[model samples]
Target: MAVSPAPSSGHLPRTSPRSPWDAPPGGAPDPWTPWAGPEALRRQDPELADVLLAELRRQRQDLQLIAAENFTSPAVLAALGSPLANKYAEGYPGARHHGGCEVVDLAERLAVDRATALFGAEHANVQPHSGSSAVLAAYAALLRPGDTVLAMALAQGGHLTHGSPANFSGRWFDFVGYGVDPVTGLIDHDRVRALALAHRPKAIVCGSISYPRHPDYAAFREIADEVDAYLIADAAHPIGLVAGGVAPSPVPYADVVCATTHKVLRGPRGGLVMCPAELAGRMDRAVFPFTQGGAQMHTVAAKAVALGEAATPAFAAYTRQVVANARALAGELSQLGLTVATGGTDTHLITADPAPLGVDGPAARRRCAAAGIVLDVCAVPAPDRPGGCVKGIRLGTAAVTTQGMTEPEMGRIAALLAAALREDAGTRAEVAELTGEFQPYP
Candidate 1:
């Protein structure tokens, strides 16, 4: 095997063999290639192959501004598509229920170690299937069924896992919902503290899906301390930024931090949980036997790759650009007659009301879809007497930044968004023209 020198940047460069594979010294068969012929899959299953390829085309041709999404590196994709997917590792690295787990064990260990290092946590579990799964495990480890917990209200920019009436958390636990300040679109620490004292929750959860500003971990810790509650930080949206050192880490303050690998982390679509050493055992067990079954070894390996990439200087630089691009885009949105939540952003996420531009969030989302501008619709905190009534659009810079877009591109995107919201004809062509310069796959 040839060992080429590492690239100048942290990102692993993708490699492809020539059309003809080289013969071995003993004239042995050629090694397996990363990619099979394009027709190989189509021949077997044309319908599914078309769906997959069409998805690829859609991703490559549109602006991916969804805050919960990002483009994974080719190296990470390679890991996801590797033979490790065949393994059924059911437990942690050292202990497994299945045989032939030795190799996959090392992959899991690598993922755990890299995750801990990336976010400066004492312990990490990289096996949970998704961010929601990670949070479920965190709750399982810390609280019993029916224990009173405080979490952001779902209508107030909180995630579904955070006390949604439709989720397990809402059903199994006695949850007290908190909301952001009606005027500022930011969390009101005073109100949260009051709620904590009033409810005396067993745990206080701090995190959100659409909130644009960074959470005050220390403040939440203090409030939780006063109430004798475990503090759980659902950092699914900001973990990638935290890894890049562009955002504050919750590992130090929250008893357990739950995150997703995909968002800004630019890894596989998986979940990660980090905590202090004392809680490691419970967190692991919760993820393994309690919430989920066999671990997806391939996703674990991809997470390891992503965590390593995140620790690199280049990834840090990329995260910084992600934030900068978000701030610039928020300004552009504000100038284009949109009411930007918090007036601007401190992270890769931006929440704005397109109602000022003659379309509500859902309408704007439909229009943006027609224009091939990918983003999400979210519930915004009512900027008046806070009960959650306003609907708005949410955008993230991670995906576009991953495509090598910058502030100027953000302005163009915001312009395109405005034109689309206004129902201008021929806006999708402009969007296609812009996206053509930044193909996510190419």
Candidate 2:
């Protein structure tokens, strides 16, 4: 590969994105945004620079099917790598414990304002370190250590924080899990109501990691009310869709909504929590003094940038295309003999069993990985029989959609995936050829 140096042009030359496809959300654009890092790092550490270049090549070569990943815009990237990373603001804006918190305070305020407006919530806390951390804060704000919590079963699509024994949620709280209908692959509301009545839990959580449909927020709210339980929505995956108005907003239904800025939101890898005005103090304190310390100011600025971008009509179109692409992939993959969980998806994610193709989930994942079609495997737990489960692969369209691929490309990806699972050695080159036409970063 040949290398060329970026001119030492001042901020005046870097005003706006050259094209709407790579446009920055409106504001004073980042003065230092670059497709790659500044030339200084390449000159200072060529070894580390090689690793970064390799990652760039890999991203451009492989299909990123992981549901939890996306390419942040260069503007967001600039914010994440900004000087705000040097700050140590240990509390909410306007009330930080640190002395020099004035400038970062403005960025945090903007993040909260944009987040609340984007999701139609009364309050927002853009501070928790990750989705799991945000979940922990929601718990700290609303539940006691020994309190009973009713949530989706881990084996049935729930996240680890929904009460996996290996996580803090399970060790500190009593968890009663409600599962989906085995045949339909959808949450059985009757079962959820029954569990709530039987347990009388302090809180009822509504969310999942791999389930392909929206959780019935209204129904969950009703059940929580019947049981006098607080409704906590761990909306880590669908929050971006919510922002784009492609999914139902849980703000009006759930008592606290915990989410990640990174996933479909395409922000920095961090968390945000939103709630009604009454719970604002508890949520803020929970994110700060309770579960975390200083906020990552750089990430906070990046989140603001992403949220602003999400508020645009362009991002809404992007999200719609994401779901469209997911549906196309699901339909084509199922046609190729994989059993798509829930028949298809109402969101950007799809979970499919590859066993009909003569490959289990892990094996299929390896086959795809070898051919550069990266993805993850998940289990669809069956409660009727002891230890009964279905192994499956989980993937999403956010990243590819961000890269501007649509349903036509989705068809090609499906064919390539099926070919890989069938041990076709030519799949790798085909994948590279496809992704090469749709680079992640402009």
**Model 1: per-residue Cα lDDT over 367-411, one tens digit each:** 999999988999876656345557889999999999989999999
Q: Model 2 Cα displacement at 379 (Å)?
A: 1.1
Off by over 4 Å in 2: 1-37, 381-386
- lDDT for position 298 in model 1: 90
Off by over 4 Å in 1: 1-34, 37-39, 384-386
Q: What is the TM-score of each predicted model, taking all chains together?
A: 0.92, 0.92
lDDT of 1 at 102: 82
Per-residue accuracy of model 2 over 1-442 as CA lDDT, tens digit each: 2224446653325556565333355653333544334453564577997898899888999999999999999899888877788899998878989998888998998999999889989999998889999999999999989999999888888899988999999999999998988888889999999999999999999999998898789999999999999999999999999988899999999999999999899999999999999999998888889898999999999999999999999999999999999999999999999889889999999998888899889999999999999999998644454565677799999999999999999999999999999989788999999998899874
Q: Backbone clashes in each candidate structure, one number apiece?
A: 0, 0
Q: Which pairs clash in model 2?
A: none
Model 1, residue 61: what's the lDDT? 87
